[model samples]
Target: MLAAAVAFLFLMQSAPAALRSATAEPRVVTPRGDLAADERATIELFRNARDSVVFITTRQRVADFWTRNVYTVPRGGGSGFVWDEAGHIVTNFHVIEGASEATIQLADGRQASARLVGVSPQHDLAVLRIGGAGFAIPRRVPIGTSRDLQVGQNVFAIGNPFGLDWTLTKGIVSALDRSLPNESGPDIRHLIQTDAAINPGNSGGPLLDSAGRLIGVNTAIYSPSGASAGIGFAVPVDTVMRVVPQLIATGRYARPALGIDSDDEINDSLKRTFGVDGVFVLRVEPGSGAERAGLKAAARTVRGVVPGDVVVALAGKPVSRFGDLQARLDDYRIGEAVELTLLRAGERRKITVALGAGTE
Candidate 1:
């Protein structure tokens, strides 16, 4: 009975292993299959979109150490897209930064010198006009509203990354209504974030929707490696639509400004010292709205008068940072009246200030 029981236990273990092996199917290799519907659609859009995109190169004079002479050098490069039939191509201002010369390279291997007709550093936008006629620049991509973009919607990006021309990448919208710093402005607000691959030279290129509409301008990406790590940002189409028209019409963007020029930034130290949470007024411009409204700049006894107005709120919206003021002004036109909450003489007061044209 002991021998029979030991044999039965061995059979149970061996039988299960044998049965498992018998049931396991052999690996089979198959040929590569066709792309799925979404992939095919992406490919089609890329083909159509590639024609509209172009590579921009800017040249600057650099001193050559070896030759001990100054010469023109390729300063930098970025992407651009056809804007209109008048030969206007739109790109980022930073793309052409320090550019003594600008040129556009088309997908068909046609290179042409371009003229910088307009540049708005405040908006990071520029317009380049191609020389010579008869080149049918691709259609002005239909602009889609970015205000309705929901998180996780698929997004597509095409640009010349690292000078590698015409690259396509896909991802989803990671966020919206983001704020970031700009070279010309205090901060760029209401930016759109995506996981699409945006890298160097991708700036100023179009970020498109699934239907191939121009959604935003691929501007920046968040990556330490300087490569796309599933985090990218873009300037929304609404801003583009708003800025480009004036840029093309006039050679520069003229934003309405608040006549009063005061410090826009406020920090914790400032909050504790000043006992306020709104923007700390550095100085109220003479003959400006703040001055006209009897606004006084904050003063310190030891500092011998560092006088400026601290902005606490604008039209009921709290102003914690200077960017808040800039953003609020961006939404309004010139000659608009806005209510302000000012902290003067360690006391809070409400005042009205009329916005005027910004410095040209």
Candidate 2:
């Protein structure tokens, strides 16, 4: 062993250049040809859709109890996209729910102050506007319809998940028409479920189809540890198209209603009392469209105060709960007449009622 070590040392000293040449050279570089068609498509999609995404940072003003002085503290943020060239940015309502101010970080690394345009907490959507007039977007996210989306369709999500800006994740549509509730908002129905890796900062980001078109807004993830669980939900773009214009115009979603009053809890109680299923109508607005349409509410009869007209369906769509009915009504607008199927005295009848304004 000693002789071998001495010989190796002597060889290193005698032929150090040969040893250095053997050890210092790197492996030859291999030539990788052009990317596959699917890979090229994915790259093209990311390049085209990236500019439409933005990173949002929010701040909240807090007052010190001892000095009574207010200070702005950094609040958590989420992702959004450019709604128009007018500098209107759209994000999840919960992202800036209690924020006093927010900052918009564009894809080109330019920061701009933003103002809240409006919010729809029920839908979990909010809009912000930059003070730029006729701002032109270098790239626009192609809007696509979500009503025809099917399970197992390729979907892409671009966002700033975990504060990592402009991150892209790919997955398939895990499900459709999914309904889930947020702790801060009402039950959101007709959601598009994807297996995409959506985390906290990914909220309000666009969920695009294979053609690089906006299909849904990445909103919530079904995670117990507040991280990605492969089950993420997004608000459908169809709902977005309906709610955003109203929000931009009126600062709130003027959801169409029928002017009739009812409650889910009351409906449940009435279901037991009257031995039927559906939303029980408590009262119809006096001289309203519902009353004019001959809609009846629970009233006093010779036997007792029995259930009146219980809504079973709307416009050929079955409505089993109050939220179901609420979600169905969102598809219509004010003054639009829709067929309402009701259960009157254990008999079924359909009536065409013009919807009035409703509060979701």
Q: Taking the candidates one at a time, how many backbone clashes does each contain? A: 6, 0
lDDT of 2: 0.88
* Number of residue pairs clashing in candidate 2, backbone atoms closer than 3 angstroms, sequence gap of 3 or more or interchain: 0
TM-score of each: 0.83, 0.84
The digit string of per-residue lDDT tens for model 2 on 176-286 reads 988874444346889999999999999999999999999999999999999999999999999999889888998888777786877777677778887787888888988
Model 2 — TM-score against the truth?
A: 0.84
Cα-based lDDT for every prediction: 0.81, 0.88
lDDT of 1 by residue, 155-273 (tens): 99899999999999899999999887653564777788998889999998999999998989888889998898888998888888888988888888777665655444334457766
- Candidate maximizing lDDT: 2
